[model samples]
Target chain A: MTSHIDTCGLSCPQPVLLFLTALRKTEAKEFDVLVDNEVSRENVTRAAENHGCHVTAHQEGNDVTRLHIAKN
Target chain B: MKSLRNIFVSPAGIILTGAIIGLLAILLQHYGNPGNMGICVVCFNRDIAGGIGLHRASVVQYLRPEIMGMLLGAFVAALFFGDFRARGGSSPITRFLLGVIASIGALVFLGCPWRAILRLAGGDGNALFGFAGIFVGVGIGTLFFRQGFSLGRNTTQHRASGFVMPLIMLALVLLYLLYPPIAGQEKNGVLFYSLKGPGAAHAPFLLSIGIGLLVGFLAQRSRFCTMGAIRDVILFRHWHLALGLAAMLLAALVANVALGSFKPGFEGQPIAHTQSLWNFLGMVTAGLAFALAGGCPGRQIFMAGEGDNDAAVFILGLIVGAALSHNFDMASSPAGIAANGAVAAIGGLVICLLIGITNIRRGA
Candidate 1:
């Protein structure tokens, strides 16, 4: 099962930190992180990319963005 | 998907988000949200603390529904979206201590990050020092961040861990409902009600709740954060969230001009002091703590709603910190910074620097 991390209402480093924590905990090689706003979206994606994960993003409605990242 | 993400990520969308907050804050003030305050996280926390007898300051006690409403609004949103997680345990005690000292710093300055912005919007030039202090403080934190300062990693656990703070907010709302201001009475039904001062003036309860809910929802949706706004600008030349604050400034300025609340002067500003040194130092300390803590007070409250127990602990620490300041006269007054307040501010700086050094890793 994919670990879904919701980081809405959180800011840049926070979303990134939470996402990293989830990445560390989950055995699943695949992950999905939900965030709101561009800053968070960018920061989370950057962190995942730094971890050598491949990331694809999807935007929901007007505000939320979901990023799917998988280990190469 | 890239095109979709670009929509709200554009300059206009973030600006609109900031403008909405600014306009709403000014309007809330016009309708009664504390003079020149609009929405201040620290002050609201202090007021709530006093209402619950954390401090017996008779003139500044009121159980503000906006705080309660904000938490609940975020809680509802988190629940609906299936993001409610109760993960914590990342040096909770350390975070609690940071919140304590940060509250002391904010109390000395008489405002939090949002209040600093609100004060500037209302044309109080004293806020210039506050802004400067925050920049310096956060810059210091940024230095530590560059050097690998970290509080440690948060670990996930039980799902119920996240709901603690929201439950506390619910209890507070119940207390607010239980106590109706007795017109001339200060204490009513186990709650303290201020008859004068900033706490005495407020928008109607339901109205405040409605506005708080709207802000909570929008802020949650956009991840709007004051500290993050400035931090991003400092760390990266990114101006996305910065635009939100700029929009708030412009919109609040316009609203102040239209409402005749714009009094551009450094002297006799509402609930502010002319002691420039303390103002700068105060926010510097608070700002550093805020940066170390990784979010502003508003962000903490919203995080609590999402069931982050760490965030809730920070708020609890705020309550304890406020009480300590008031009980020991460690909080500054309009007259000037109290002796202990100065001591506390300096003490916080030393401790925060120490924390920064200790958390720095060799490779990190």
Candidate 2:
């Protein structure tokens, strides 16, 4: 099952850190993160890629972005 | 609604916002702010520190309204936009120490990242060295980031916790009004004032705060950050933030020319020094510290405004660091770098590198 982490309304480094925290705590290979701003989206993507994960992101609503991060 | 948000948050939107801020900065200078220093976070923080008697640098003492305005502006924007969430606990001590080091580095160079760009825009040749130093410093930080440097995680807190920094800003505003600067007076029972020098020079209080609030509101909305601009470009090849930075530079340069304040040279440029080597090393320390801390000084204030306690601690560190800089003679002057400023700059760089190395989450 894919883990879901909602990080909407949080700022940068927070979103990125949440993603990292989720990565650390889980043995699961996939995570779905919801971010609200472009800075958070880009930072989370960079962080996921840095940790050897593939990130596929898509726009959700007007201000929300959802990213599917899978471990490589 | 979507289109309106886009107009405020899109790439073009950010560029326009940057241009506006740049032009306003030069305008602030043209009015009465120190030359080429319309809005320097570090310098202003230093002055604020002195104003509060954290240091005894009489010539640089004043309760700067711009700092309070930025924080209050960001606070209001965060609340209106529903982004204020109280969170911290991610190595607060480490972050605070990094803030100190960052302020020291900035002082040695005599400007933060924004001021360095503004200096260049105003045609100060010495800023070139500072600019090059920031690039190299951020480059080093990128290496740590690639190696998994992390400051850990921050959990959610009580909503009231988020209001602390904003409340402090409001308190400062109250203090400024309660003890307004009296002419020819250095101190008025409480709070210090500079009778002369950069601290004494300022645009009208209302005008300064107004521009500051507007900049903060737009910056919060756009997530405008000087350190992030270079970091994104270096690490991810992203140009979004870089566009904003370039726009600020271009706009500031044009404004300087139009205002007839554009004087390009290495010597006698306002409150800047001619020590090229120290200037480079100074920003190298600042850039590294800023990169490791996750934001520049301005960004930290904005984050604090939005309820990040860790960023708030960093801002406090900057306040204390400014005190230490002047007390220990580690800050530079137009005359040149202090005797111990260069040593402290090197020490700051080493300390930041150590923090970067120690904070890496191995195998995670």
Candidate 3:
């Protein structure tokens, strides 16, 4: 199963912190995360990668970026 | 053009922004903007409060052009870069209270985080305690982050809402031009000007505003923030923001050395005090407030400029808090923290802790 989290309009550390919490609590090994800013995008990716998660990201529009994370 | 724009947000770009700000801040001082204080958001805000009759601190009253210029610069950058958005509605009152606490704490320590770094660069040992307090405060805030604490997310708003702060900045500039200060006069029309003291000692208006605008523009692009530097390191072990800090310190230190203004000691550092405990406690309050509010005062200003109404509210809180500090004797001086300063600092810490704990979302 894949868990989805929307962090659009949220600032740094919040998005990453949310990602980490979801990663820990959920039984799922994959996440589709939405972020609206560059800092949040970079941070959520870094946090996932640091936790040994494989990640792929793509810009969805002018402002929003979506990331796919899978636990290794 | 895209690649060049990308450089402004790159690691080297952030470092370059910091270096330029650090160097220019020193130049601001060399041109008469208080020693060891090139760019202090809290102090400048306090002075602006006084300038606008929000406070009556005679020695610290001026309509600082630097403050106005920064907002304008950021506004220009945001507009040009297509980063401007009219967004806000995340716990604005709470953010305002946080700004008040942040400003009071900074005033208690006699400097904001930027000034603390500049003080260190100018060889003031007193800043060591301030930095330590900030680390501890941010560390504590990080613990709350681990527990899923957030102030909620800002929502999009009407475009007019985004222009308010920049318009205010432009109005202030107009006020300055219309009511230019008169020598030996404290009041020029409705505006206040310092006849003497730190507020009176400023670099040329154009110079101060020019440096401020440049910094504001670059900081908007780089997202340079002092509190964010420490918070990023503590939360994710990320060193991206820390590089900006290191560059600022290094650049400022070298500039001070070349200018022969490097004076190392806990005592007699210009516009500073030697009260170690209060200094630590003051910044402890400030750092936590900044973390809770999600940016340092400088970043808050830039954010406000870029159409963040929440940030604008927070900036208003800072101005009001500055007024309260001076009026109620909660601000510090070169002699030491005022009688109520320590109490205010403790109160600020308690408020921050309350705000931090109460805002947490369990089972997020």
Query: Which prediction has the highest TM-score against the true structure?
Result: 3
lDDT, candidate 1, B1-364, per-residue tens: 4454445445676677678878888988999878778888888888888998999877678888888888888888667655566767767898898899889998888999888988999889888999999998988987877565677656665887777788888898887778867788989989998999888988888888887877776565455677877886786545667788888889999999998999999888888988888899999999898898888888788777877778888888888888888888888776788879889989998998888888876422
| Model 2: per-residue Cα lDDT over B96-207, one tens digit each | 9999999999999999998998999999999999999999998899888777787876666688988999999888888988998999999876899999999999988899
Candidates sorted on TM-score, descending: 3, 2, 1
Runs off by more than 4 Å, candidate 2: A1-31, A34-38, A42-66, A69-72
Clashes of each: 2, 0, 0
Per-residue lDDT value at B54 in model 3: 96
Better of 2 and 3 by DockQ: 3
lDDT of 3 by residue, B138-252 (tens): 8999998887788888888899999999999999989999998888999999999898878998999899899989999999888899899999898877787889999999999
> Which runs in model 1 stand beyond 4 Å of their true positions?
A1-42, A46-72, B1-13, B362-364
Task: Write down the DockQ of candidate 2.
Answer: 0.19
DockQ for each numbered candidate = 0.11, 0.19, 0.61
- Segments of candidate 3 deviating more than 4 angstroms: A23-29, A45-62, A70-72
**What CA RMSD would you report for each candidate?**
5.9, 4.2, 1.8
Between which residue pairs do clashes occur in model 3?
A: none
Q: Is candidate 1 or candidate 3 better by TM-score?
A: 3
Q: What's the best-to-worst order under lDDT? A: 3, 2, 1
Relative to the true structure, candidate 3 reaches a TM of: 0.95
